[model samples]
Target: MTTVAFIGLGAMGYRMAAHLPQHFDSVLVWNRNVDKAKQHAAEFNTQAVTLAEAAQADIIFSCLPTSHQVDEIIHQVDIKSGAIWIDCTSGVPDIARTQATYLKSKNVSFLDAPVSGQTIGAENATLTFMVGGDAEVFDKALPAMQALGKLIKHVGGSGAGFAVKAVNNMLLAVHLCAAAEGFTTLKAHGVNLNEALDCINASSGKSGVTENVLSQRIFNRSFPNTFALLLLAKDTGIALDLVRDAKLSAPVIALSQSLIQAASATSDADSDFSAAVKMYESWSKITLE
Candidate 1:
């Protein structure tokens, strides 16, 4: 029976890890919070083990919050030879490359597979996975990834997944801010938000932010525990760094980054990224509600 170990049992990680036991005979889980790990094990009928024990599996999957956490896990765990390390975290590409090289030295292959859907998507098993690593490594992990996501593509070699993820999220941030600002402007002018959202959805102005997140979650006040604004801001920072490193000019992304940064500073950072609309509301002294 194939064995797999999953680390980080947070919102998305918990659901993603649950599907692993359905495909693999033995699935082990670990979390910084032992209770969460134990809860997941009980819920999924899997084993909750220490990081050292979990690392012995044929494959080790990590969905941490940041590059620092990934570094800590890699340093603290005792992963065995020939185990594949798949990172589901949205981290810096250079850090992903560095970790890939470090893991490869220990005979463990590494793949960066950052996902593009949120909590609802995870629960529905419809996330999009952008993978960066050897084609063979991606092929080997396809079946397991398929259990958690609907779309999986190998974007490029080492660190490319994060690169693509950063770019994708940067654009998402811009689109979301645009949608929120437009909605807020319309609402200020006495336009009904629901009707305006309907029109936007039908028009070329629609985007994933408008159609999926803003209209569905923000206007409805469902929240739905998708990715948080703080995390989104972190990703924006990563994207900004990438552009800065490349000496590329992206004025719009820079503006979006400032908006996200301002939102992250507020109490709403713990809320969903669509909460950026609240920032504009605060600035304009107009309540979205």
Candidate 2:
């Protein structure tokens, strides 16, 4: 019988795991919060298992907060031989490589398959996966992964997926920071914020930030907690670490990281990432709206 175990049931994990039951004969879910797992099982008609019990499944999936938590979970559970572990955490590339090596020694396969498209995409089973592992193993896992994501690409080997994800978030940080500073300057110089955004959106300066984030969140002054500031800050730090490891200099990313870190300090860990623009507002004495 085909059995799949899903570890971690946070906002993204909970929704991502919901799709697994349709693809496997049996679905097992585990979370640090035992009650969350039980709740998911009750709602989805799956079984909730302990971490160790989860290790027995034919395929193991994890969507944790960081690579550190992923590392901890790997050691705690005595995973069965030949089982494949798919990690969807926004993790460090070096840690992913180490995990792959350790799992290889035990005859189990490992893939760093971090995802994008956020919580809404997770709920719809339309996320994009950047996977890194042996090409043959990826082909073997493709059918199972199709249940969770709409687009899945085998980026490279070992840690390449995590490296891409980290750099992706780092670029997002740059965009957000640059937009915040530019919009603040425009607002300060007597230009209407919405009109400036309109022009930018039609011009070369447009991005997802200007088109969506500026309109839905910043200008509305809602700043709802779609993505947490703390998490973005963490991902930016991971990207910076990757850059430093390569002996490269990234001044813009360095500055963006400092700004995101400082912005994270202004609010609770669960605060919306868009609230970061408020730091620029406070500095320039101008609001985006």
Candidate 3:
């Protein structure tokens, strides 16, 4: 029987793990907070195991806040030989590569399979996974991955998934900041925010941020806690690291990162990532709506 274990029960991980029971023979869960693990097991009809028990599973999946937490868990657990570790964290690329090399010495296979599409996508099982690992290993894990995501691409070897995810989020930050500044300019001239967005969405300036995040989250002023601004800030920093490592000059991304980091520092931990636009609004003395 193929026994699978999922570690972490955060906003995204909790929903992502719920899909595993349908595809695997046995599903196990572990969390830093034991009660959350128990709660998930009760709701999903799965077993809640300790960290040690989780390590013994044939396949182990983790979706932590960062690669630092992943490193801590990997060192704490003694994973069985031939086990597969698939990490879904928005993590540092260098750390993912290090973890992969360390796991290989113990006869374990590792994959960095970071995801996009945010919390709603996690709940709906429609996330896009950018995976990095051996081709054969990706093929072997495809069925299990399919249970939790709609689009899964094996981007490259170890660490590449994290690299792709970081760059993707960097672009997202750029779009959001650019949109915020542009909208602030339009608002200065007393243009209807709704009409401006409609035009922007129809124009070359449109992005996922303008169409969805700006329209749904920022304009509404709801600022729901779907994904945290702090996490976005962290992801942007990771992207900056990758950019600098490649010796590329990315002034826009650097500026966006500073804006996101500043916003995250001031906003509550539960604030939605779109709240970064609030900085632009504050600077322009004009609200989005």
Best by lDDT: 3
The C-alpha RMSD in Å for every predicted model, in order, reads: 1.3, 1.4, 1.0
* Whole-model lDDT values for every prediction: 0.87, 0.91, 0.92
Candidate 2 lDDT over residue span 105-209, tens digit each = 988899999999888889999999999999998998887789999999999999999988988888888999999988888877899989888899999999888
Give TM-scores for every candidate, taking all chains together and pairing residue i with residue i. Answer: 0.96, 0.96, 0.97
Candidate 1 wrongly placed segments (more than 4 Å): none
Off by over 4 Å in 3: none
TM-score of candidate 2 versus the correct structure, residues matched by position: 0.96
Leading candidate by TM-score: 3
The pairs that clash in candidate 1 are none
Per residue, candidate 3 scores C-alpha lDDT tens digits across 59-161 of 8999999999999999988998999999999999899899999999999999999999888899889999999988898998888889999999999999999
Ranking by lDDT: 3, 2, 1
**Ranked candidates (TM-score, high to low):** 3, 1, 2
lDDT score at residue 88, model 3, on the 0-100 scale: 98
lDDT of 3 at 174: 90
Candidate 3 at residue 250, lDDT? 91
Look at candidate 1 and tell me the lDDT of residue 117. Answer: 82
